[model samples]
Target: MTRLVSYDEAPPEVRRVFDDIKRTRGVPDVNNFWKALAIHPPTLERVWQNLKQVMAPGALDPLTKEMIYIAVSAAQGCEYCIASHTAAARAKGMTDAMYGELLAVIGMAAETNRLAQALRVPVDAAFRAAPPPPIPKA
Candidate 1:
């Protein structure tokens, strides 16, 4: 059985935000992460607000944003973040093919990034000064 903790044990402000979070986010109960973070309700609220604001629908569609999130989480090796964002990506309309390509690109980029770091590759002056290549006429 899960250990039950009384909200009275939590800080008064934490309890207020926890109640608000449950109501606003429509979760029947507080998630483990939030329960732990309830130790710092103000910080939790700030982080949640910032995340929600940035992730809301905008110039980038939700699925595309989710894909970006997944790629970053994968690069950082945050398994929890990867799982959450991948599920969000799928919910926002990612397909198997798209997910495959996304993973491939992320993997390739990660490999190249590691190689560059390992080799201590410096940006060449020639490449930095190079003009844009001419576009082929379609």
Candidate 2:
């Protein structure tokens, strides 16, 4: 059981946040994570706004962003975040094949990262920003 405020019993400020959450997510239920954060309304609002900005469409599509969130959550061993982001990714049209591929890539990247860290490999100059492409002859 959470020590934080419950959505139904939350104060006006918290309820306003909850209402915004419902409207934005189009879901009537508030997740326990949000309810737990309600203990500090300011933090709750700040996090919600930040999430909105970060998750909104931009260079990357929402599905890709959710997949990245899932990857990071898995790497950090945050089961709650992994579960939530996996569901979000699936809702955004991720398939079993894509999930399998994503996990494979994540595993490979993790292994390579660990190896590089253990060996203290220096990043190659070639990997740095390509020397400004030779200026085209006017």
Candidate 3:
């Protein structure tokens, strides 16, 4: 792994994003993920900005969003994200019971997803949605 950037050694661009992250999350320092991304300041800033917007409370409550993030992270097998989002969820008032239930749901979903894939299950008409918009050319 690349060296994690320290705040004292960071350049202006990294420092700006780091400062924002620290302020927004009310943390003494940004986590190792941000530290790693610090090597690429543009990506660090972009991800930080996007995370702030997406994780902010809106239609769904903060705890709900955090749990959803945890579920997706678990499914992707991203250990770091799962751990990080779990902590965030706890802070957002996720009790032990909620965590247990979330884990059960994640496990069941994973099992069913794999089984469906292996069986080549067709999508039910009622469960199908309209196609998404075309991706924009980069």
Candidate 4:
């Protein structure tokens, strides 16, 4: 909250990233998160690039990615991220019922995760294995 660089106040490099964000998202302005990051232009550019790439559709659909982001944000108790991604998910056609179910799942996971840690549960042999192989190329 200390430093917020608006588009008018941003350096050319920061403005470039802001432009991309607006253009890619089809919006008139970049959000406050980007404005905050614009204080550090290099990091702003890097994070923007990474976000664009990661949020692009590949294996997971865009809506699913947004929902995943919302879940992680909720787990981390980040109000900004939760609100932002929840808006995105709603824009992508998430129903009210889906939002309710997602919250329920998050609560259940938190309960189970804490219980497991408290009980010091050991990993089952059947569940221990090498990471699954990468998806085959088309």
Candidate 5:
């Protein structure tokens, strides 16, 4: 039988963090991922803190960040992350049309990345030997 850790069964430190997360996020209970991470409370706490801080409104707009997240998840083929982040992106103001386009772009990028990897394409010798592009004049 599959085993899952109940929040009450979590380690002391994990329980603390889980309680805080429940209070802050207004969730009923922790998910399986966190329950597994609860085996290492410090790592769980650190990851939770970092995720909250990074995902909060910041210099990069939340929707944009969510788009970036969705793109990365799609590239990595993380179905759970793609679903979650896509929902987050929609919540942050992504339209259906925008989501469709975002998905198309990610798909194209993934295909190109795979092609590049498969061919082991090397950089043009001249491009590699040349200095970086000059900055545009103001």
Candidate 6:
């Protein structure tokens, strides 16, 4: 069903990408996305490298990054990305409770964002600054 070159039938360059993917993920299986991308070796390599750099540990933890990916994917209505990120999140130790809470928060935020946009809500001045601490008792 794939319109692109299959993994086993790929050229050396594409095969190299597949090998790297296997080693990086520590899994023998390559997903359909990568396999489809093999038709264009440069694109496949570029995408893989970018993914590696972006997903690597930084200011944000891997799990948090995955959750963010899921949220954005959901908002964008990208079912493939959502499912992919959800699985990655689970593999990164996301619990069922955390997943449920994540979805709830995403839904609430989306609804409120739409409501705010519809009403043309202005930014509240109070929300722009952190609250000052209480004065110490004498």
Which candidate has the top score in TM-score?
4
TM-score of each: 0.71, 0.89, 0.90, 0.95, 0.73, 0.85
Shift in Å, residue 86, candidate 4:
0.4
| Per-prediction tally of clashes | 0, 0, 0, 0, 0, 0
Per-model CA lDDT versus the true structure: 0.80, 0.91, 0.93, 0.94, 0.83, 0.92
Per-residue lDDT of candidate 2, residues 1-138 (tens digit): 666677768999999999999999899877878988998899999999999899999879999999999999989999999899999999999999999999998899999999999999998888775677676565
lDDT of 3 by residue, 65-133 (tens): 999999999989999999999999999899999999999999999999999999999998766876776
- Give the clashing pairs for model 1: none
In terms of lDDT, the poorest run of 10 residues in model 4 is 124-133
lDDT of 4 by residue, 21-124 (tens): 99999999998999998888889999999999999988899999999999999999999999999999999999999999999999999999999999999998
Please write out the lDDT profile of model 1 over residues 1-138, one tens digit for every residue.
Answer: 234334668777777777876786576776665666665668767776777788878878889999999999998898878997898689878999999999999999999999999999998999999999898776
Candidate 3 lDDT trough over 10 residues, lowest sum: 124-133
Off by over 4 Å in 2: 1-4, 130-138
User: In model 6, where is the ten-residue run with the lowest total lDDT?
Assistant: 1-10
Q: Report lDDT (Cα) of residue 103, candidate 2.
A: 96
In model 1, which runs have C-alpha deviations exceeding 4 angstroms?
Answer: 1-31, 126-138
Deviation of model 3 at 26, angstroms = 1.0
lDDT-wise, the better of 2 and 4 is 4
Q: RMSD in angstroms, candidate 3?
A: 4.1
Candidate 5 residues lying further than 4 Å off, grouped into runs, are 1-3, 118-138
Clashing pairs in 2: none
